[model samples]
Target chain A: MIHPFQSVASNSDGSLLFFVIKNSILVYSVKDSNDEFKLVGEWSDEADSTAIIKEKVTKEQQRQLAENTAKKLKANDGTALPQEHKEAKIPKPGQGAPPIYQYIRNVKLSRDGKWLFACTDSDKAIVMFEISAEDKNNCLRLAKRQRLPKRPNAITTTIDDKQLIVADKFGDLYSFGVNDDQPCVNPEPILGHVSLLTDVAIGLDSNGKQLVFTSDRDEHIRITHFPQSFIIDKWLFGHKEFISTMCLPVWAPELLFSAGGESSIFSWNWQTGELLDRFNIAELIQPFLTENHLAPDRFQNKEGNLIEYSVSKIVTFDSLPLIAFFIEATKAIFTCQINRDSGKIALKQVLEVPYNVVSLACAETTGELIATLDNQNSHDKNFVAFISMDVDKFHINQSKQQKFDDFINSRLSDNEIANIEQEGIYPLYHVASLRKRGEH
Target chain B: MRAGMSLDDPSSRRQSYRAKKEENRKELKHVKIDAEVVAEKVELPKKRYYRQRAHSNPFSDHQLEYPLSPNDMDWRKLYPYFYDESKGDMTKEVTIADIGCGFGGLLIDLSPAFPDKLILGMEIRVQVTNYVEDRIIALRANNVKTNAYQNINVLRGNAMKFLPNFFHQAQLEKMFFCFPDPHFKQRKHKARIITNTLLSEYAYVLKEGGIIYTITDVLDLHEWMAKHLTEHPLFERLSQEWEDQDECVKIMRHATEEGKKVERKKGDKYVACFKRLPTPEII
Candidate 1:
């Protein structure tokens, strides 16, 4: 599934979530008690929309605000007052909203969440927005905009947020500075691929000095060192299909989860090209159903055709895999969890979304707050929605864990158990059984 | 007689002194002439003054007369000069360039070879150039052409400078450098045409690698041409590959008057052929 308007970010407190909406960057605060997130601002490139009016107001309002404050003087009561004998007043909330971008392909927030970066394939440039701490609803101050050499296919920022690396459709890798006031300069080209580069991810390697970039053309993920020296330390290749998305495991920097276009996910050692484990989620969920599959009644066309889809994000909740994928043709969201050590997958349930969701991202800290953006939604209204998962209720639904464990224990003989233990296969079977019973 | 033989006779002393000086001059002149004769005899064969039938021609018993004047000689008028009257035979025709062709004597002598090929005498001297031109016109030798270039040509002009321009690259096929002026000087190296640079240029103008034949009475000049031409990048010393390829060397040996001269002298002639290599791609 292709998602043109999606925003992926890790919050300041290490909480990761992404919004797949059109106009505004929805920052989901997963760790904070306030499950609510402030929309920084929304802008659109459409000619007839109110976004253009908002742009004019924001620019003119900022100028007026600065003029009014400059004329302020001390009053008789020792309070600051305007020199023209007028009161200096702060603008009301949401009064001069900034214009939201129209077609956002991908968005990334800084590690501190103070800076927001958004890319639009339509414009072929990445625009940056600075978040204000004083007011959450206030429009994010437009800091800078960097135009890439080609249209960006995927973008990811480094851990320190000092460098932003973007991979374009022509397989050219571009990087820009985050703190620069002018347009970012000096694009460094990364080599190794001869085809279109569809996706890129930046994460610390085992040594924490090299940056790894994954391309869709092949399974080889190139690891490049920081700074301007042209050197490739290693390449990791094991998967047979194009790598759709990759995420650095929160618990282990050495481990990375990559999902392929073949509807399979693999857990690989970042330093070594070892395929620790891999599982096809689509194959595992086919047998458990009563042949009464979820009807295609949810799609806009509603033709009873099975939609083939690939996983987009693989996050873990309490060591259980929480994978997010989109149904083909229909932009509905679905979540499934697989055990890493066991290679078991359970197709839990699918979420009913109002619009076609182009992208998905979940918070890394708690995996509780999940945000999604739909392609059809308007800039300001309902482009992004945050879903709060109830962990207690999820655990309560997995009451069959103990029952499955007992059944497996009763069926295994002493000799069989000893042989299975020797081969290190017992734990995998146990986890598989538990997964079949909806237990983590 | 007793008075004439007096010790203090000034007239006798004067006469004796004059006679002694005359004898010494005569002795010096004879020594010089003897040396010249020895050098010429040792370097050139007497049979060079009379040419014989070429090695390849079996049917014709034509013979060549040496030192034919540049005038009154044409390939068509071969009766008395090249044709053997007793056998009624005429020599075969061939083209040749007379190098250092002073007044075109060699060119005139080799005109019998010109029925099939033209004979040209390249001169580098102004007066000698005029003399050769007048001689060719006066002889009405249609097959013979002479040019006044300087010091290196038949009368004058550097043969090395104009040879490439006069002939297409590799057109001449066979070149004869006979009795080339040996500019013997340690410091005048640039004036020598047989240097490394000139050899490379020669190789360039030669065909698919053709050969350059050098003959000089001066042993040093012959060695110089051999060493430098062989060492040039585009040329290699002709090896066994030249043994069976008799056509190129045939003309050099029997078709030119100079070749006959070398053969008659019984001089140990040094002959070397440097094959031009194919043009190399510029780096």
Candidate 2:
């Protein structure tokens, strides 16, 4: 109930739910027709070295935090402004006793399902777990876990599975070799971002060079060379709000879907940086609010309420690039299918739920969406919710997909289309921050 | 319809008319009472065309009664069955809503059926809304045997605009749209109860698995309601089994004043129902 799962992952079949709860990654068999979550066993680091590293990292980070606070107090020695600011903006510290223990931020399975990458929250480490699917008794065995100079905000393996890219919250990206002859006890830093990096994804560009797509809090989506992340590529800059999530749909690797906590969802071509299509959800979500009698103003942010609805998480099904997104406050999860060919992405359906979701994942083999939901009480108990999208229900016939292919042909004027595809990179328009008349 | 009077039943209607006359007689006492004065003053109060305001805040009188938050609301008054939380052992809140309740027919019919649930009706017209209020008050007053009509209440509200002011997100399980005013003119299309603009608000109050029941005799309006609801991203047209098997549909088809009049005239009644779908990840 109280921080049961920091991160969760589903095996392709969705039968095994592997999540980082409390100290270890526990596996539960959640097969059909059964609510009984039979705990298989906890997947441990199985190394004395991990314990020593965790101890060393926690002591070091705690010392650094204390020094920073002391330095801040010394800077404000001559004034009461610091005290006034502290009094005005001291949010209830729900963080609860500054994590004396190490916690996991994310757990992702490789495309081939042979390895698991578990990223630490503040211990600045990425623990690699090798899982053999064939082994029933002990499928999960920790291979190696390495500490980094900075904690990773996002982590993902490349398509070819040779390199692992990790993005830190302090705004830097580093690539580590999967099979480096000499293991790096402390992974060296590589490229950097000026703002806090929210997410990083790996995909091949037109020339098949590994391009790392990174999204940040400053509304910038940058495409950079994989190993040589310092070599700047084109920037996809259009989001008016903080871009918290970014994903390259496995089915449509050429397209990158990015969403802030806004009502609009954007997808642009990664190679050309041309924003292929933009889906506005204001009309769709407004009715939902009214029907449920929920005040829209409650979700409005301080920045003039333009970005009221926030996408807490985005998980995509590998089958059709059918993506699942959640609005944490409203506890609403919606799925939409993006037709790369048509340049039209329509919201497909909404999943029924009554719990606040902290994380979302789509089961690899089952095509079902799994959510780690909060029970909407002071206790903050958690339970997993699942919805299966039977393949037959979504019949993606060629004719229907072809009908929407000529969208820009009919919808956009000659000048508008020219403006979009100028020099092959379409300007990603900001839906929430559209300039008013005579505002230039 | 006379304010605080029953129009469907002429027997109970004259009480209000007589009371109005009595009040007029008392006003005559302030001046001079004459036979000629009674003749002119006895007729209905002038040519009664409702003066429609541009923005109708119909629930003005009930503003003090409205709670700022759902938790602050005194639901015990609505659901008498669960007067005390610890004593009544009530587990679920009232999740059903009836929009534009004309004569309290649907409320009286559905109240006992869903005894554990709380149901609310919203009518815009002051007099019509008052009549329904009086009707429920009378029914509950005489309920010494079954304690019926304890789970329902009526209020004057422009539900389309102020819905968010009342319920929280996904608070409603079922919403009834029976014989809503057909703002037929193209210009007044926005004034119609159902529209793309209002549906999103409806989706917010209704839970992921909620259903919206719409019944109308007007074929054009029916088509319009059905078209807009089906085209909405959050709702899907409910299956035939749901429409046929649902008990709420039966009450909606036969319980309202419009439904009774439509039946008397042998008019065709078109019904469309859509389920609020769960998010796509929910499958």
List, residue by residue over A28-109, the lDDT tens digit for candidate 2. Answer: 6654553434555356443344555656656656665566666665444664234222212222226565433345667887
| TM of each candidate vs. truth | 0.40, 0.45
| Candidate 2 deviant stretches above 4 angstroms | A1-4, A30-38, A44-101, A134-137, A180-183, A286-307, A376-382, A391-440, B1-283
Question: DockQ, in order, for the candidates?
Answer: 0.01, 0.01
TM-score of chain A of 1: 0.60
TM-score of 2: 0.45
lDDT tens digits by residue: candidate 1, A255-324: 6667654556676776665667765666543432332233334432455554334444455543435655
Cα displacement (Å) at residue A10, model 1: 6.5
Candidate 2 RMSD to the correct structure: 27.5
Chain B TM-score, structure 1: 0.50
lDDT of each: 0.48, 0.64
lDDT of 2 by residue, B1-283 (tens): 6543445545344555545644643353222223343333223232122222223332122322344344445565555455655775444577999988766788889988898788999877655655565556555545534656677887766675356556766889999998988877554665677876467667777888899999999999999999989877778998778889989888889988789989999999998899998744211
